[model samples]
Target chain A: MSSQSVVFIGAGNVATHLAKGFYQAGVDILQIINRHFDKAKNLADQVDAQPADDLNSLMKDADVYVVAVQDDAVQNIVKDLSLPRGTLVHTSGTVPLSQLSNAAPESGVFYPLQTFRADQELDLTQAPICLEASSSETYQQLKALASTISNQIHPVDSEQRKTIHIAAVFLNNFTNHMLACAEELLSKHNMDFDLLRPLLEETWQKVRHHKPSDVQTGPAMRNDRQVITEHLDRLKNEPELQAVYRVLTESIQRKYS
Target chain B: MSSQSVVFIGAGNVATHLAKGFYQAGVDILQIINRHFDKAKNLADQVDAQPADDLNSLMKDADVYVVAVQDDAVQNIVKDLSLPRGTLVHTSGTVPLSQLSNAAPESGVFYPLQTFRADQELDLTQAPICLEASSSETYQQLKALASTISNQIHPVDSEQRKTIHIAAVFLNNFTNHMLACAEELLSKHNMDFDLLRPLLEETWQKVRHHKPSDVQTGPAMRNDRQVITEHLDRLKNEPELQAVYRVLTESIQRKYS
Candidate 1:
């Protein structure tokens, strides 16, 4: 298992983080493949792996061909790969496991469930790696590879993975947009965005211990119509934000009342 | 300043935390007044202060009288207080400073900008206290009392404080509801909420260093209609959640595209 090799088919944020994690965990990275030769070479140098501009140049002998490309590009990448059956996998949550059937008989998914930034250091050990495969043998090999970098390995099928992915968007992507809206609101009032940092930190802390509903507080939760009116009135200048406030307020009210 | 005394006119979450912080900072908590005698007695015992079940029993000589009641009750409590013209203050974000003008001449605000739970211990040093007063002298006095517990004190007016309060809702309360929605979505699939903890922690970490807009990522931000369609289709059963998803998706698309 320690001698298992993985070839990354994309040099993106997920690929960069996964490559570093696998390299540190003693998994051999045989090659970095991407349409952009410079980007491929950049990641290859970091992991001491060979760089290939296309699948034709990829080393087919690697135990795993991790196609960590965009969701749309995943199928094309898989179709071009001339790897042995049961050796190809992609890091996607929405794409079905059956999408890999034409490429290999034993294809699977090796998805890491965390947002990645190329400039920031990622602690993969803390992230849960989701594994799915067409066959039990492929699942075992994928689980073994995931276990090297993370203790939390989940055997989630494509359907369940899609559910997790959508939820992640709500928690991570939508929540970040809320922060942006807050920043914009504060800046318009000449207030520092730093003023809300402690509150934001505490919000996360509360969810970690209590259910979000049990710990819910604010105008809508309390049914304080006055405060809700004031906030909505303030947001009237921005119709989009006003709509967001209205929908969320109605949602919270429905949940509580 | 060490001889400064304050009378708290409530025993709820904010009042309890503020009283404890002032007591720890060596400010004398003269009394705890509440309509609920048992709650007043409970907080009074913790701070070694006298407990009063009515405003008539409240100590009149305290340097600052902190009326930390609910938003709707603030004005009523202030009008009922039989204190000196320049000693009454209230802790509210949206309520104006003028709300206390009829109750006292030296009315001011000592609003701490943090969410509180009575059962949880709060470190005031990290929470900024927003201060406001009718007079410069009163402002200095209120600032001095707030400085005892927290180093971060901002002299924000009623108008600006209202704006900050609205923005805080967007960041803290609304973002939390988003987490609740995510939790509900995950639970429907029999998934463990712990799987999203690392992602949540990382989301907060990223905001601490980068602008939310600069770090934004997802199907909405990328304008990937396919993934968005898949997510919305999955959420079809929960119409409320589906509306929220569509609104947020449209909001993100508008922001980025």
Candidate 2:
């Protein structure tokens, strides 16, 4: 495959991470476009790419236009953008691919299945790529492109991608919040949060090898009314946490029963 | 400097994890007692201790009797048991140290800061030890025992421990629950849950060196109403998750604001 020029249209965390990942993978970023001129400059400078805030200027020679923006803005960005026909894709979990259906050089999704934080570095090799295209030929090109950066590639459609994102929230966001809650409670009691780190890490590790429902522990899963009541009483003021407690406890019990 | 014989009351997660940690640190486990004889025997076998179903049998010749029972039963167990004064402790975060005051043996708390599942191997070296004792000498003994297992020890009274427990909820249970919620939402759309693992891991990793409020990420932290709304609407039927979304979004906002 010949080296194709890639264009990044966002300068946010995901954009920056993906830009860097692509740069490392030998994809010559033709240009980086952002609403904010300085943001586009910063990202372009980091990746040694041409910085162009106006989409029209970069669209002249862009082989691929990657719309790496917020979920709500994907359709509008794709619709209003003046990119070449059949040459646009949006990196969104929930947004449909049809938004880029308008003539683009070759539209496709190169969704990186990993979280991005500006301060953290990413290994694109391990990051799964959820690739999709409007047609079979484009799909092959996108798959080839994704394979350049990552070995873990999935040719998933929008619906499947959305489902994966939903699961991610439960496993990542909700789990992290629960960890935060546990930390909050333990810290208030003058107990060290680090104390629970072992058990917490083990909780996830067990689920990695064993089925989650099989390895469920803690008061809720055990149906220990005594501990649950005590913890709930402590969380009485935090209505959100109490509701969480009830739902999770019920879920755990239901899974076991 | 001399090793004293020890009697462990209860064979639950806490007791099992603690006893194994203590035994590794060279404590002599003389007896183990639980409501269920088989459970006690199982735990005792692992720790190389004799298992007994009755109080008198387990208590005989025991230098220290650690009560590791449920919170509600703490008082009852203390009152009904006739252990000789000057060596009793309960491993509870909520129960006051005074609950063991009426008991013959002096009382204190040797709380291990971690969640425990029966199958998970607990690494106490990093586990925080929250300790309080009836006397200075007792405190020294408990401190020595804890030091054998972990270096991170906090001399917390029951009141302080309560605050610590509250903090624990934030760091542990609540954070984990939040992760679960996000996973739930992503799964609804057929998204792979693995996408969030790196993000979740990074969240915890960041806090090891940084403040939670400083390192906050996500739609809530960014104040991205669009993403939040889409996420919430996606979780429309999940009242608990929706409530969590509302509460956590507000909390993160206030925290950063």
Candidate 3:
């Protein structure tokens, strides 16, 4: 596996982290390819890989070609790439494996299921890499590649991967938005957001051992109309927040009561 | 401070945890008072304190009286209590110190800033205890009591405490609701919510060092309408979740863009 080389087709957060992880795992990263030459070079320097500005420079002998661009950019990039059959794969949860079918006969998905920030170093050992391929041999190759970095790997079909991606949106994207709303609410009252850190930590810890529905607690869970009314009244000035508050409150009440 | 005997007015989640903390810190828990005799006796047995079903059995010699009842019940319980002047404090963030003022002249607050579950044992040493008192001497005594269990103590005023509580609702209550929504979405798709554990852990870990706003990532933050629309479509049958998704998406867009 170490002898089999790979080339990354983007220099974004996902690409940077995946490139670093693959490099650390002793897989030879052959090149960093991107339209933006400087960004490609930047990541290339970190992984000790050559930077290429266009598809014309792509290494044809590489065992794997990972397209880790934005979801919308994936199809276009894969279509333009001239990789050998079964060598090209895209790293997207929502995009279907069929999207890659037009680009290469042996296309697959190597989606890492975690949020990536270029500035922050993530431990990929714990991240689940969802894999899907057009053929079993291609899957075995992708699994071998993914197993180099992550211990948790799953073979999910295209439809299930899309479902997982939607779940990811709810868990990561929407949850982060909730935190941002929390920070905004705290800022308006001149309260330190740090004050909520312990509770935030505790909330995450609870879900690790208990079912979220079983562990849910709040004014709405208890059907405490007085407290809910008080909270809603407090949010009168912020109509958007008030809508969120009311909808979630109603949902929680329906679930519990 | 170990010699300072205290009486708890309720044996709910907050009362149980605080009593355990105080008892562990070597402060003598003199009595556990609750309307329900079984609960009072149950908590009293654990803390090695006397159990009382009514305020008529309240210990007059106790140095500090902690009213840890429900929010609406605080004033009523405090008013009915018969204790020495300046010995009363209520552990409520939203309830004003003045509520206890009518019950005792030296009333204050000893509110711990963390979520508590009756069945879960939490280490109070790391939990922030917000203190407020009517007089300097009472404040000093409450501070001393708080220092015995927790190192993080803050002298927050009534208005500020209310603001803090509201912020807590947003951070803890609403955030848990978001996790619940995520779990529900996964359950519908026959996907394991455990698949989200790493992402959830990462989200909390990221916000610890960075402002949630600075670290926010999602389709909404990136203004990726295609993915957002796909997610909304997936949640078509669940209108309540769709409302939550739309409002949060709009909020994130407003904040970032």
Q: What's the lDDT for all of these models?
A: 0.87, 0.71, 0.84
Using TM-score as the measure, the top candidate is 1
lDDT of 1 by residue, B138-222 (tens): 8888888888889899989888898889888888888999988888888888987778888888887888778777888889999
**Candidate 1: stretches off by over 4 Å:** none
lDDT of 2 by residue, A120-144 (tens): 7767677777888988888877776
Sorted by TM-score (best first), the order is 1, 3, 2
Clashes of 1: 2
Q: List DockQ for all candidates.
A: 0.78, 0.39, 0.66
RMSD of each: 1.5, 3.4, 2.2
Which candidate tops DockQ? 1
Residues A14-109, model 3: lDDT tens digits: 999999999998899989999999999999999999998988888887888899999999877877765564378889988888887866658889
Model 1 docking category: medium
Question: Which 10-residue window in model 1 chain A sums to the lowest lDDT?
Answer: A78-87
- List of chain B TM-scores, one per candidate: 0.95, 0.91, 0.94
**How far out, in Å, is residue B168 in model 3?**
1.0
> Can you give the TM-score per candidate against the true fold?
0.97, 0.86, 0.94
